[model samples]
Target chain A: MFLVKIYVQLKKDILDAQGKATKKALESLGFEGVQDVRIGKEIRILLDGRDISEVSEKVRQMCDKLLINPVMEDYDFKIMEVEK
Target chain B: MKFGVVIFPGSSGEGDCFYVIKNIINKEVDYIWHKDLIKDIDTYDCIILPGGSSYGDYLRPGAIASKSPVMESIKEFAARGGLVLGICNGFQILLESGLLPGILLQNENIRFKCQYTQVRVENNKTPFTGQCSKGQVLKVAMAHGYGRYYAPEDVIKDLNKNGQIIFRYCDAQGEIEISANPNGSVENIAGISNKKGNVFGTMIHPERSSEEILNSSQGRVIFDSIIGYLKGVTVNGK
Candidate 1:
């Protein structure tokens, strides 16, 4: 079995309003020298498979096709074996 | 002329479009549910994607609904040069489905804006705006949290060069000023069209402006323009 963790974030060039607002809140809370803050989404999936490479490819395809909007977001994933 | 308003689950604006077509404009209209296969999409003169929180705006507004079955038929209908109009949430779906250029970001103010605003007609030659004169202004209601339009710089340049920009938020007198732009869209863009001018997507809800009781009938001109184009009549004697 494998546990996949996917992170999706707005592209660097795209404006992240929610992220910006959160950063402002942090500043108000007295977080000094906080340069920048960006928010993203994390999705976890479990697959009943043994081949890490094959499952990785399938996860990438899933991200490209539906999990992320390529126009404004970027995504990355990590896969690790989980004991059945 | 026949009109079909697509109804995605959680979409709340289909009824407004249906009312505009059947009651205000007095035309043939029907609802196309999202799950159904639209085998006869070619029979309709125009397919409308109305405003609403489709699929509960999950995973980004309109993202889930964009991949629904009916959108495939919408894509085919658009490819065949049929008119497609998407308003508000509909606009987001069009973008998510790649039926239109650009993406809609959250409003700069990060608040849901719902009010009557003026939009200057940038291009009236398209089927959806035939009744409008170039530079004319129309009062329309915009209600959405994500209506700020964004595109690659090159795409913006191309859209400008090709006159695909159909509407811009403007002052009552038709000045495209930043103060009038409620959502911080690039160049105050409120709407745009595909290169072929057959597919249009706008953030404004024209259907909400189609009645005198609504205090604005200017929105009726959009529907009139579609009827006019289908009837082969030139608007403004053009």
Candidate 2:
């Protein structure tokens, strides 16, 4: 078994209004030295596969097709083997 | 002229579009379900995608609905030079389906805004706005969370150069200003048209402004323009 963690976030060029709001809130709460903040989504998936490369390729296709909108967002995934 | 208004499961704007076209505009209109194939799409002079939370707006505002069966027919219709009008969520669908150039993102303030807005007509030559004079201002209702329009720099340049931009958010006097922009759309674009101008998409709900009760007949002009274009084509055999 493998556990996959995917993270999706708006591209750097795209303004992250939510992240900015959160950062402002953090600053108000006394957090300093914060230069930037970004908000992103993390999706976890479990797969029954032994071949790491094949599983990665499938995940990539899934991301490209549905999990991400390439126009405004970017995504990356990490896979780790897990005990059944 | 016949109008086909496509209704996805969660769409809320179909009824308004149908009501305005049939009762107000005095035109033949029908509701086209999303699941059904639009085999006779060519028979209709114009097809409308109205505003609503189609497919619960999952993934993206218009993402799931764009892949529906009827959209293929819409593509074919547009390719054959038929007019396609997308309002609000429909505009999002058009963007998702690649029928339009830009994508709509979350509003700049990250909040849903539903209110009356003023938009200036950028181009009057297109079929969708032929009835309006150049630079005319129309008062319309805009209600959406993801209404900010975004495109790459080059595409934005091309849109400006080609005069594909149909409307830009403006003040009551028809002056484009940031304060009047409900959403932080690039260049204050409130609406746009495809290169051929047959496919039109706008964030504003013109249908909502079509009746006397709405206090704005400006929206009726859009429908009038479409019907006028159809009549012209039939008469000219163009």
DockQ score for model 1, please?
A: 0.72
lDDT of each residue in A1-84, candidate 1, tens digit only: 999999999889888888888889999999988888888999999987659999998898888777888888888899999988
User: Per-residue lDDT for B26-58 in model 2, tens only?
Assistant: 999999998989877878999999999998998
Candidate 1, residues B22-123: lDDT per residue as tens digits? 998999999999998899988899999999999899998989999999999999889999999999999999999999988999998899998999999999
Off by over 4 Å in 1: none
Instruction: Give me the TM-scores of chain B across the candidates.
Output: 0.98, 0.97
Quote the lDDT for A68 in model 1: 88
Q: What is the i-RMS of every prediction?
A: 0.9, 1.2
Candidate 1, B46: how far from true, in Å? 0.5
As a whole number from 0 to 100, the lDDT of residue A9 in candidate 2 is 92
Clashing pairs in 2: none
